[model samples]
Target: DGRCLKDIHCLELAEFRWTLKQAFGSSQPSARYGHTAAVWPPESEIPGRDKDSEFLFVFGGHSAVSELNDFFAFHIESSTWVKVDTGRQTSGPSKRFAHKWDWSGLKT
Candidate 1:
């Protein structure tokens, strides 16, 4: 019910508690809302709590002025944030906000 301060919380289901994740490194994404996040990609490519891709991807959000098109990934295992370069020098997707993205085996 307060400021997050860029701290990620992980819910401990077994203990039924909220544990603030111990994050490391610096390149974390800037605080943003109205973006998109998915544990798994559009496809079931790399499930959670695995070795290869334990990441939470945050993409495209709104700012106080306009819609944003930045992308970031939070690696759960490494407890680090990385900016994902979409390799797009232009617009990637239509600017959107307050949208929920899920994988239905197609584009979100």
Candidate 2:
């Protein structure tokens, strides 16, 4: 199916375990799977005067009928999901899965 889990899990790292927790936001990423996710730790380099920021970005996955290149970001502080417009699909990376995203070096 194309259904996705919008609930973020709560974890107890000290015990090396986690428990499913209920959370709701104004909006959420469309039902999807096989997507790649990356996170930027809170209080890291970012634009503007934001603070205590934790972000989770999900990208690239396919549904039952088609492949997808859409991206969504979860803002931890505000507990919301926002879909980012990445422009024309043809100009962006092709739809794929099991990809890795990382920040390399500190430039500007």
Candidate 3:
């Protein structure tokens, strides 16, 4: 009863109700809380990929026993979750929870 969850639900504006999403992927993020998520490249398509899908990025949350800094992306159109590796060269950010995330649509 006290366990965390990785399940995702979506709200349908037209229906005015929430629907549980059936997500699929090779790997899934662990159950977490206090994580931050955001939709990136808003209103644009990811280059070299199909334009129909958008990604939701999730990061930094507390699991049952400890904080986490793992990163992941959920593909909306495909209903898939993909883990993002930061690579061995970089340690990335430390474990954290209850964080905030915002993306500035800055263009160079």
In terms of TM-score, which candidate is strongest?
A: 3
lDDT by residue (tens digit), candidate 3, 7-49: 9988878999999999899878999999998766565435566
**Against the hidden true structure, what lDDT does model 3 obtain?**
0.82
Q: What is the C-alpha lDDT of each candidate?
A: 0.68, 0.68, 0.82
Ranking by TM-score: 3, 1, 2
What ranges in model 3 sit over 4 Å off? Answer: 43-51, 106-108
Q: Residue 77: error of model 3 in Å?
A: 0.9
Question: lDDT tens string, model 2, 1-108?
Answer: 547545676566789888764444655676666778866652355545453566778887766556678888887666678887878767888887656667654461
Local error of candidate 3 at 54, Å?
Answer: 1.2
TM-score of model 2 relative to the true fold? 0.66
Highest lDDT among the candidates is held by which one?
A: 3
Q: Runs in model 1 with CA error above 4 Å?
A: 1-5, 41-52, 105-108
By lDDT, is 1 or 3 better?
A: 3
